[model samples]
Target: MITRPRIAAAFAAATLIALTGCGANTGSSTNAAADDFPKKGKSIELIVAFGSGGAVDTASRLVAPILEEELGTNVEVVNKPGAGGQIGYTALASAKPDGYTIGATGSPSVVVSPLDPARGATYTRDSFQPLGRHVVDPAVIAVQPDSPYQTLKELIEAAKANPKSMTASTTGLQTGEHFALAQIQEATGAEFAPVHFAEGDAAAAAAFLGKHVNVLVGDVSGVTDLIKQGKARVLGVMSSERAPSLPDIPTFKESGYEVEASTARGFSAPAGLPDAVAEKLEAAIKTAIEDPTVVKKMEELGLQTSYLSGADYEQYWAGQEAAYKKVMPLVQKKD
Candidate 1:
């Protein structure tokens, strides 16, 4: 007989079974969605871990439209600049592992931020899945057009004679410019008081142009306009070879200083992103980076196109991490 108690128990059992089935279906649906990434209408967010109008943001914006066309979805470039890219890196790492949220990752800020416990960065090298690399912007040292230092050698000698007398602009503490400064100090015993602009290259360049700083330690992409307009004079490029964009400027190597540093920009998704979704995103990025229009645009901005696929991109990051770690002590801010 189906008594009241028996009926209640039967109902409970049915409810449990239904809930279990719903759970299984939920997981299956999630897997299916990941397998069929983009889903036709959902837009992808491309986080730029720097200020707008800066090199990273500029690159992200340049590629967003191409990525949108290639992936058949909107690619939104969101700037989350602050704390020398710590805020954006944390945001990118904390995002859901779904491929919808990817970020423009650059070194050595992205690599060295987590390495230093002081930065308290929540994300490490493993927090991201590199999709593809875009460019390698070589660093440059520039002074006012009327500055006394005409050659890199003259600037180094003056800085060596009066350590920390000259003020140089860097994007922020422990950024690419700071690292370049450290490399110069370590190699040549020249020290310039670093003025940090956490807002990114634009701010740093502005400070230099406004005469707030004596020298500008920035990337080729950041100062390309100034260099072309003759508003600033480049002392040297911190690259093995003379940057094609600044072919007239001499490299640090040419000046007998062994310092080569450049910032590599790329796209990366949150770690644990689904394999199918990651593959799709990687392929889309590869296509966008290789587009002729994109290539020309990057070159016009003084950014050299250096494309690397997902696996190779990750390896590049790994190598950068190792290389930066060795020099971390040299560039870390002293308490």
Candidate 2:
């Protein structure tokens, strides 16, 4: 019914329309996906399992502005504290795969809850898809600069000689720092009066500085502040080797005890996030972590910026799971 000239003109007009309208086409799933992703103008929820003001919360807030710039929407952090982070991880697992809901979580603990049934978890490693891992904060055993114990050896010997005579503070019960404490007991046969604080590392630092506790097990990121202020002195690191940031500080291994531990922080979205959308989020996170400003901020926060994307992040978590499985027994509260 139509001549060749008319058909050619119609084809040219359609081509022009498609180019002008962002390549949208009826029944074109690719075009639909590209447009629908992030659903522009919609906000993304960032979940922090612990209460406000902790390392995870601070890291999430820093990344939020960067994500907002990249994703073109507000990134809101929701604090849902319960059961030592099980509540938040459960919410992340149960969230729809639409890529709107995301969470910042720590390794060893993230891996801990799912494997340790005592945590009463509803999620597994497969629950949420990891976007990327950004930070690895090694743990440290610190004391007040003017404490009687000059070295880790002196402190352990004293604690070993008299159980509960010396006190130790941890961020929480069965947390990574707590686990490190357990390892100290296992390795050195020391008995310390373990104190729990919901305020996490900052509280750990404060307790030791205020002399509320004789010793504090805290993340390198958290303890660095105290060290810089000349309030606390690190006795030993829990990691296998001295942290590059603290070259002079020796690890438990280097100090003659075997304890390798650190906290890894990263983001993840609900399971089954469409690959396209997940990739977008991953790229944004990677870019943010690599930014000079972000890098400087992380250094100031005492966090080491280590970006591990997708499979690399998963592999790291799995490795932590294996290591923690072996170390979990050390942390049991002896009920």
Candidate 3:
């Protein structure tokens, strides 16, 4: 479970479900919303919470053309790109619930934002309708091509030996990578200096590749280009199992550190969308994301397609909301 929405505080999550029980079931309501959607020429807006060129933005751009072909309309990718994904998510939360203003963002914005009040996110789990999950990109520990650390164990031991001397770059403060790094610190008793900047797909990887940062704590997809260019090497992927994109890369667990964290990127619209419209949007998303060509492109970008549509996507996300809270205490909020 990598990304999700409409599931918030424990008690509030329960009450939110009670209030919006229309989304609890399957099929019957979907048919109603599917009828008369788009009318053939509607222009739909797709917002990407992170900056252009990042994984989130890349996913949206890749799907936009195919989505247009499927829906018979224009699908524009709008990048808000700030506040560690809060800005675009808020835009989606505040957008009209007419099925034309859906947005995509990573999981931490959905799962961990509520725990950090400093991020000032306006949308909670109840604020939007989930369209579908697009990608399950696990984080990886990547070091410079010529770095001393050749294995996950070596990196952990080195960090433990030199405390703050080793630095790990992330996309932003308190972001998913930051939390993942914290989990690594807690699990291995190895302290690392967390260095973050926006647009991790570029900046974080650049920092690590240029030797400005010692390590990159970013998604596998985010560092694909770097790895492909031989600018970096992955020490381990942060997933329960090895990622298909990089089958040879060991998981943190395999390296004797029980850590698994990933960003699940997906689409969502403002709450209260008609069942027919939601269903229609979800169908278009699934078709676009799972297309063979699209799947090939994702693989090239080092991403794996993991589509969960409508109610099924919502159900899975609701569970992750609870899972994220357990790691919240370890994260240090940034103002």
**How many steric overlaps are in each model, in order?**
0, 0, 8
Each prediction's TM-score against the native?
0.91, 0.85, 0.86
- The better candidate by lDDT, 1 or 3, is 1
For every candidate, C-alpha RMSD to the true structure in Å? 4.6, 7.1, 11.7
Over the stretch 49-69, how does candidate 3's per-residue lDDT look in tens digits? Answer: 777788888888989999899
lDDT of 2 at 142: 83
For candidate 1, the lDDT comes to: 0.90
Cα-based RMSD of candidate 3? 11.7
Pairs in steric clash, model 3:
6-125, 6-126, 7-125, 32-276, 33-275, 33-276, 33-277, 34-276
Off by over 4 Å in 3: 1-35, 39-41
Best of the two (1, 3) by TM-score:
1
Best by TM-score: 1
Q: In candidate 1, what are the lDDT values of residues 1-335, reduced to their tens digit?
A: 68999999999999999999999999888779888888788889999888999999988988899889878888889999888888898999999988889999988889899998988888899999999988899999999999998899999999999999999998887899999999999999999999989879988888888999999999999989997898899989998898888899999999999999899889998999877788889988988899999899889988889999989999999998888888899777799
Model 2, range 232-290, lDDT digits (tens) per residue? 89998887767766778988887688877778899998888776788889998888778
Greater-lDDT candidate between 2 and 3:
3
